[model samples]
Target: MLKTLTKTLLCVSLLATFPAMAAPDGDMAPSDKQLAELYWQGQESLKKSDWSGALERFRRLETSLRRTEPASADAAIYWQAYALLQAKRSTEAKATLEKLKRDYPDSRWSKEAESLMRQTQGRPNVASESSGNDDDLAEIAITGLMQAPPERALPILRKVLQGSHSIEVKKRALFVLSQLDEDAALAELGNVATTSNDAELRAEAIRMLGISGEDTAIERLRTIYAASKSSEEKRGIIQAWMIADKPDLVMQAARSETDEVLRKAAIQALGAMDASKELRQLFDSEKSLENRKSILQALGVAGDTRSLVGIAASNESEDIRIEAIEALGIADDDDSGENLVRIYQAASSPKIREAALQGMLISDDSDSMLKLYKQASSKEEKQALLRMLTLTGSDATLDLIEAELDKAGKQP
Candidate 1:
């Protein structure tokens, strides 16, 4: 059933296309080719078990289609929830599923969402089960060990880690091991993180080390990060640093790491940590335009509106300024609409003004758009505003569009 659903969703995505409508100010909507590229990239990420990467691509795809293609948007939503569930973020997965059901209830993806929702409810309680499997029994034992003395639990957990148990059971054992205060337990967890053959298990152990929040565990992560050659492992360590709230460590990597991917991963981690001050400093000192753009994106993720506004208003590079304007829309702060409108009005470059207009759309500032429509000086500008208003799908905007059409028809 899951395979059939996946094939159906893929067909829906492949067939999705933007309507043949010109965007305001000559800004073009993403072409069908671009959307297909995003979908294929997301599929590749999922095949590699790169859940975060898949989620990001699918989320962008969903946002691109939300206003124009409800069916495609719902399919993206289902994939987003699937990625979240695979990442063990059940709470977020459940929320995403709820959104699909609430907003796209008639969608074919809704039935797949129901199955995912059941999975998000999690495994059955161990105590009530009569015929428990190895994984279930392992969970039960781990639960009992939580109350036992550390000395007793540590030895058993160590054996479990060394045992031929399933990866799921071993993961449970590893997590329990991380909770132990003993040096022996930390060492055992570190060994798994550094030496495990299974990449997924190693990543889990690394995550558990971060969750442990022990200085020793943190030091061990640094050691492993310094020694590892795999970008995936290094990225995992960067995420672990974010979870441990070690922004300074992440900052160190962001500043010194030679790998652009790792550096960007660190920047993203800083953003997730809300290290706005650090991000601001990086943005100032960084010489690479690409890295600077990444910092801007992180700032948006961090909701640093003041910085975004400053860049949008004063950045020397037109491209950078436009990126900042788009970031403002992504930030969607209380003042974002006003700032976007101000930028739109002040921008001399058609591209910059178009970005501001798109920002307004993203921020859903219909009143501001309508105000701009009334203030527009050219027929082209008014037409663009009308098109934007139509996309908003508000009754008021629709009425305004109708009146504008009538007036235009009465003109010479």
Candidate 2:
């Protein structure tokens, strides 16, 4: 009974894949917006199971696209036929399918139409008929094994992995193997992660191991990370560690990993985990300018405005200071605007001043900005403040502009 159910599930999966097939080759023309809206209405109607409404919309779409986009018209016709089948009008559905096949023999919808034709004729779907093939049978067998006791299922799943089955079949077997709670299942998954000849399968097993959240699985992941030479594999391990909420593991990679790209990936993961203190420490001790910049960016992602404020005010390189200021803008913490105002006041370089002004603008600190404009000693500074204030379009700023205009007129 479970075997039959598994075969049925396999057939359903194949049928589901039909609608997900790629659309026709060309991009839709801009003028097709109205037609696109009509198509969306049809899809929405189909989703609601309003068969008559769906048929009406698609019928209209078919007539409209019949001339310039016969391929799209064929798609409309296919959906119209689907609506007919759902409404239990099989005779009309068959007739519509015949029209699709006869008019656009090369349509992308032809394969799906043939399947619908079998449905109308009360014959089994092609998916069910193809279930006797070796790959399909293997997948079906593995899916069925998912319902059995773990002790009985694990050995069969293991054989499926070791045998000459297709990658898809083995992936299904691995998936079932991962679902089991036994020690044997973890061992098998670890074996696949470490020894699989296929890189894709190995990555899949690694991801599954992390998701298992078992102590042994976490240890295995660390062991894999230590020995793996592939940057891609190491990056995947870092991501898995992030998923498992192991920030210390991620920070370890961020600090020690020699590959710059992988190290940045780990830093980014730490930011995502909101490891502000660790990132701050890394920033202070790190000697490489590029990695320090990366750590600052990570701090921004962690929303650690205090660290960013310190970096912005530090004697770091102008480039690093500007990066921190910009990250502060992105962080947009409550005190960011106040800190930016202070930075602008203290900065000696025109470039640093400009970056600080931009940060103020981003933080929407228009009040502090207007105050700076009032205190400006140079025409360049006032003009720069005017441009950023114009972007804000605040009434107070506009009034200030008008007042400045009057003062300039009197001076002339």
Best TM-score among the predictions, by candidate number: 1
**How well is each residue in 229-282 modelled by candidate 1, as lDDT tens digits?**
987778778877776689999999999999888898899788878899999999
Please list the C-alpha lDDT of all candidates, in the order they appear.
0.76, 0.77
lDDT of 2 by residue, 57-153 (tens): 9998888798657666888888898888878788899999999989989887887788888878983334355534878778888889878999999
Range of the 10 consecutive residues with the lowest summed lDDT in candidate 1: 15-24
Q: What TM-score does candidate 2 get on C-alpha atoms? A: 0.55
Report RMSD (Å) for each prediction in the order shown: 12.0, 14.3
Q: TM-score for all predictions? A: 0.69, 0.55
